[model samples]
Target chain A: MSTWNMITFQDSNSLYSDNLISFHDFIMLFIIMIISLTLFFIVDLMLNKFMNLLLLKNHMIEIIWTLIPMFILMMICYPSLKILYFIDEMFNPYFSIKAIGHQWYWSYEYPEFNNYEINCYMNNYMNKNQFRLLETDNRLIIPFKISLRLLVSSVDVIHSWTIQSLGIKVDAVPGRINQLNLFSIRPGLFFGQCSEICGINHSFMPIMLESTSYFNFINWMNNNNN
Target chain B: MVKYTQLGNATTLETPADLKPKTAPYDPRFPNQNQTRYCYTSYLDFHRCKKRHSEEYEACKYFKKVYTAMCPLAWTTNWDEQIENGNFPGDI
Candidate 1:
């Protein structure tokens, strides 16, 4: 649910994305705490008449400064590292989708379905309900509440396949297959664009992924076969 | 979970439209962000691919796509000439 003028993060529909938002909030806590402490110290120094002209060598102050930053860093390390590894951990995916980047468009293939490839181009001509430069003629559909492994590659220059709301960004380089792990708890439509500048039409190629139930996905597959 | 069992017996999926075409193996040699090494290495890989397999091998064309994407047309054309003249430095 990324909107044009939205300032904050979009809603989280997956576990990892929710964890990512929690981590962000955790870091923001530290930032606000440090800022408030500094502001208090600055204002007190200016308003109070507590000026000491004596020698400024104190073991207590030195120990406090050294130990405080060390403790803060340690506090920050565990959660950050935990999130880094947690997002990277990939369980056995339920399905696989291969996304290939082209000069101006994207193609998707369901290797589980005998390499069923679909060329998804930008739907420039769209009604008011559709998003501009963010919608494609054919959308990549995955089952809701299922884990998936997405393989990304490029047929031309480097392009990046990323969905910010999902907290996933992967480089699609020619001659290589980069893998991204994804799982969603709820069903929704997510959109992204080729992050890496490939050519003149870099901003044109967009990705629209829809998540539905397993039953509907099967029905869609049956209809697509005809 | 019982519903998911239908996938095994699913019929063939439809072929995508040929909208016109073709990275990545990771190598320590090209660790940097700039992929110039990929440009040249992919060229050599295409030739090496054609050499090991038949020229018309489907997989060999993968390397060709890699090189075409990484290297410019002029660079590939020049390398093609060098390969034909037998003056290319890289061994097949």
Candidate 2:
């Protein structure tokens, strides 16, 4: 899959994920790789005797190299810390959903809405139009452009609830509740799978979410109650 | 005089290997008496069969039988209701 294209991260659906990708591209394209390539070229020129470096033993060069690396590290660290805090930061969400991981399936609960829940299982034999193992019987529905909190845990072994496009990965460990915030930028279907190696049928656990408009979400809620 | 004997012989000493007993493979036709495992596996199989033969319910009769036999009636009924109402039962 990586070879077909560069296997770039999926087109991000959330602002947080988009920011993360942009930061990644900035570091790789502008800072790290660019500097590394420039250094390599300089080294190559030095080796070819095209560029003479007579200040090899100079204290100024030593100080400059050490200070420059420190400066570069600090630059990288600032944004890294900001993003980490941004991800951890939680706001008042419209609703919360609890996801409990089983051995080979996932169970989602909407606690705010009268204990509404659903078990999502992978569709083993998919139709020609559906993704092979990505399709699930039930989708975790959320409204677009709204802050939603997800509480993750496990009933059996450890399972990681990962949604690559949304840049959310929380380990679903037994007796431990992990929380993450989700804000969908648009209405669409996103697919993910249980990242943790759970059991014999671990690969069968797939996660699918359908983001809808606020009005449609209310309609869905009303429909479910009836 | 004490008889002197070699305490450790590299060739004579045999190390015991760490061994684990192999488990039997799961058989849908003759499932184990454990209802939990049997029902869970049957539930998966039922869905798998249903997905594979969407147009033909007769083809998945074996899975349906296994699931129906293994899973409790209450659980099956609840799940059937949930499916009917577009709500998936969280428990099998």
True-contact fraction per candidate equals 0.00, 0.00
Highest DockQ, which number? 1
Runs of candidate 1 with Cα error greater than 4 angstroms are B1-92
- Tell me the alpha-carbon RMSD of every candidate: 9.7, 21.7
Tell how far residue B64 is off in model 2, in angstroms: 40
Q: Among these predicted structures, which one has the highest lDDT? A: 1
Per-residue alpha-carbon lDDT of candidate 2 for residues A160-216, written as tens digits (9 for 90 to 100): 898888888888887555667777778998988899999898889989999998779
> What is model 1's interface RMSD?
12.8
Winning model by TM-score: 1
Candidate 2 runs further than 4 Å off? A1-6, A30-56, B1-92
Q: Provide TM-scores for the models.
A: 0.69, 0.65
Please state the CAPRI-style docking class of candidate 2: incorrect
Worst 10 residues of 1 chain A by lDDT: A86-95
Candidate 2 at residue B84, lDDT? Answer: 72
Instruction: Give the clashing residue pairs of candidate 2, or none.
Output: none
